[model samples]
Target: MSAIASEVLISRLADWGVDTVFGIPGDGINGIMEGLRRNADRVKFVLVHHEEAAAFMATAYAKATGRIGVCLATSGPGGIHLANGLYDAKLDHAPVLAITGMQETSVLGTGYQQEVHLDRLYEDVSVYDQMVVNPAQLPALVDIAIRTAYARRGVAHLTVPNDIQVAEAGEQPYQLVAPAKPPATAPVYLPPPVRPRDSDVRVAADVLNAGGRTAILAGIGARGAGRLVEQLAVALDAPIIKTLSGKMVVGDDSPYTTGGIGLLGTGPSEELVEEIDTLVMLGTNFPYTKHLPEPGKVKVVQVEIEPTRAGLRLPTEVPLIGDVGATLEALLPLVTPRAERPLLERYQAKMRDWREKMAALENPERDPIAPQYLASLLDRLATDDAILTCDSGTIATWAARHWHIRGGREFYLSGNLATMAPALPYAIAVQHAYPDRQVIAYPGDGGFAMLMAEFHTAARYHLPIKVVINNNNSLGQILWEQMVLGYPEHGVRFGNPHPDYAAWARGCGGFGVHVTKAGDLETALREAFARPGPALVDVAVDPNEPPMPGKVKYEQAKHFAEAFLRGQPHKASIATTLFKDKIAQLKES
Candidate 1:
């Protein structure tokens, strides 16, 4: 609503169980701010400095609480800032209602001051986007947008024109409709797929029966099928490997879980992929295909609820197109259970070995620091129920690998969009939205540098978000990419002019610490997490570390090999040749 006319909308917002909104109020929303004044007691508003942070904060709150996350902004520039953030929410299936103030409805096309078509601008990212130019249309439109956001499980934008917001309304009280939500344990259904008993299921069961070594790779589709996978694993004595996206589907404690495979994966699954006699894939489309052994070694049987994904990647030996849970339930009866193999025991032993090795890697006694060590220390000291939010880039790689998930902690990240600078906002949202849960945000130097100013916002609200800044002074992941690609590592550097992130946090009335070496790192992290309000722990790390389990495309590798074989060592640059020991000797240089 315009600064002059936000009464009814604000009143109705409180009715919708919107206690706290994430946003930085501006001129376009001046009217709404006035309306918000009336709702001070009923609603608590968190005024963030950046619209992107606001959007993400709302998204985090909504995701954690399973409520409609609300963010408000003014039209034109303010609304434009929401593009990247809205995309994150959309991809994550988060329910976010974006309320933006627009120019007067009369001067919209006339290009009046701060005039831009936000409704259209937001259309692509939002499942529902509309301009409420009429005051009378609001009660219904307001109700509809919220409903669409809830049902669609994505972002919805409502652009309220200034004039309409300021216009007089009917004296009737507007009631916000509560969105219906299914309980967490609700049974999800899939369309009945014609899995012929003789053709598909029977064939898949036969493959499982014949295979001496079987492994089931479950994706997000296998979410509700954890128990089924457990039961099936017991029947076949097969281990389960999950994609990063499907991490929560099956608990890590399950004997079937051998850890994730592909990029950012760890544990025995890395080598287990080659040994599998049959790969039974569930509801996943892992991007890397070459990582799979030749089609001959590992026969693939895939079950997917979505029919389109049945034979998506490697052509499936048997495509059982059915709900993941239902398909496993049906197939279990047909297959004969098998005894655990010696190799299975070896694989389990490797998992235990790697976990111990991982702990040592984090608390390494070396002089040159490892970022994984810092993360592990943070992991140990952080709140038991802390919501760990991570940014994309090198820090993301470390967090995904080393940060173990316990029952108390849940992860927050932009899995699809993979945008940076979401860490600060997600941290704010997690703490503000789920005050009960301990929350921490892991941001790379580049990532944290982007939204460093938000520390003031954190201080303003005294939001209890602990930020772990992996300060390598560069986009470490890209640096690794440059090296591995045989390209000269350049343009990824962030020099001394970089903001003293920890100092800035202190300046902003929050806790701050700077650690430059590997020693005493755990103590610093423990102290940071122990602080009451917001805290920033800046730990410098070696940029030369390799991003684990990364692959080289056949085409790219062939081209590079041809170049290198033709005597282009100079052309390969320092990065390409030093993939393994990037920190070797160069540290002395």
Candidate 2:
């Protein structure tokens, strides 16, 4: 038996520490698939419907568990299926390998079935791309791909011709390469430090002396300074509000815990911030500049790692650049204690009010279930520590608003691009690496359809991921966009009758549950959550009533009115205007 033949390709993958690989099987990879079937002991192959979802699974896995995510595909159509997810991984800086199986070696010059040059096709999307013509080169090439993926800079591609995968090894000895360790940061700062504006110190004093209300806005950076954040809040006796990304840095149930702010903000967190005389912007570089209060109006002090992020939001009364934890620690010693603020009580009341109003959306009586209730119900049934991966469009809006991330749970998202169909693949990587933790795939019907084939992959490996598909039949989010844009809805509609997602799950030897009503929700969710293996929960939801991320202000309102009434394009050009600086950087780079 030739060691390099396609007959035992799984052994090489096993040697590379890969337990399962995500991809759909077809022409070019038939050899590899056969090899996997013959020696199922070592490595298993996951079969997704589209190579795109396969790639997305890799991206999620990398983010959730810090491992190199692997995906494969047949040539031409399969290879083309990977671009969207690959681009998402590139933008999020996730480590992923996209493998494409090419036609037989002899067929290279002739037009064969699905014959597209795989190497050049992925040039724009991948950081490193290669075509392996010799079996001897496979080991080293695979190693390179693994390392590049681990660095999280971009994706790596390996194109294997059908004939080459089955060819005899070149007799030369081969060795697998190990990846390098990450570089360490210096322990201490060198230059003599100018004493930072005791802004944190002043803010603490203001909150203590003013004896009224105060709010702490925690951003992603807050978690890195956990003890300091907790300490500052305790000292000031203040209520804390987190940004979406910073959801549970301070523990969602902390006595001081208020909900998120901006757009789809729930919990009178915005009201709380407005009422407070002193607002501490801790470790967050919130991009929505308009959300900031006027410099002269509020006693705004920002603690940040970057100066540009701090001053860009508003003229900071106190801009301290250092570890947020360390800064907060320094400030804690300087500030006096304070009394209870009525505004904190008021904010908590608002949080309750918002939750109550949103309760209707969660428990809708309409035929199709409300997407909000579907997600909220899932959250209640889910483990407090379960990981949630949200895909783009309406589902993202719903998830961002309703998904309650507890302190220990991780929320993985593609915030930069907000791509669709990422949840399934990400679920793969997350569940594969984290066998101890439960992972959930919260995807919209349209988004889930885009990567539904990944269901087979979930079945193959029996990875314990619960895919909650908000199967509303239409791309409701996009239809809303067209409705508001005043454009003729030429392509936004998607009312196709969906195949039985649950039956497909059962056919693949996984559990599947279809929830059509509010009463059906809890039982299905609990059943899926308790299932020992991979499962799919198909919840048919309402198509109308879009998610609310922002208030319908004059600009947004005008756009919708013009589009629906006069059929004219509205002014959402504010996004372009806001991102002008980023555009300039792109040009310079």
lDDT of each: 0.74, 0.70
Q: Count the backbone clashes (under 3 Å) in each candidate.
A: 6, 9
In model 2, residue pairs whose N, Cα or C atoms come closer than 3 Å (at least 3 residues apart or on different chains), thus clashing, are 49-453, 57-425, 57-426, 60-426, 61-429, 263-549, 264-549, 362-373, 486-563
lDDT of 2 by residue, 302-363 (tens): 77765556766766667777557767767777767655546556656666656555554554
Q: How far is candidate 1 from the true structure (C-alpha RMSD, Å)?
A: 6.5
Off by over 4 Å in 2: 5-17, 25-43, 102-117, 130-144, 160-250, 255-263, 267-353, 359-361, 364-368, 460-464, 486-513, 533-535, 561-589
lDDT: worst 10-residue window of model 2: 181-190
Q: What is the Cα-based lDDT of residue 435 in candidate 2? A: 84
Estimate the TM-score of every prediction. 0.81, 0.69
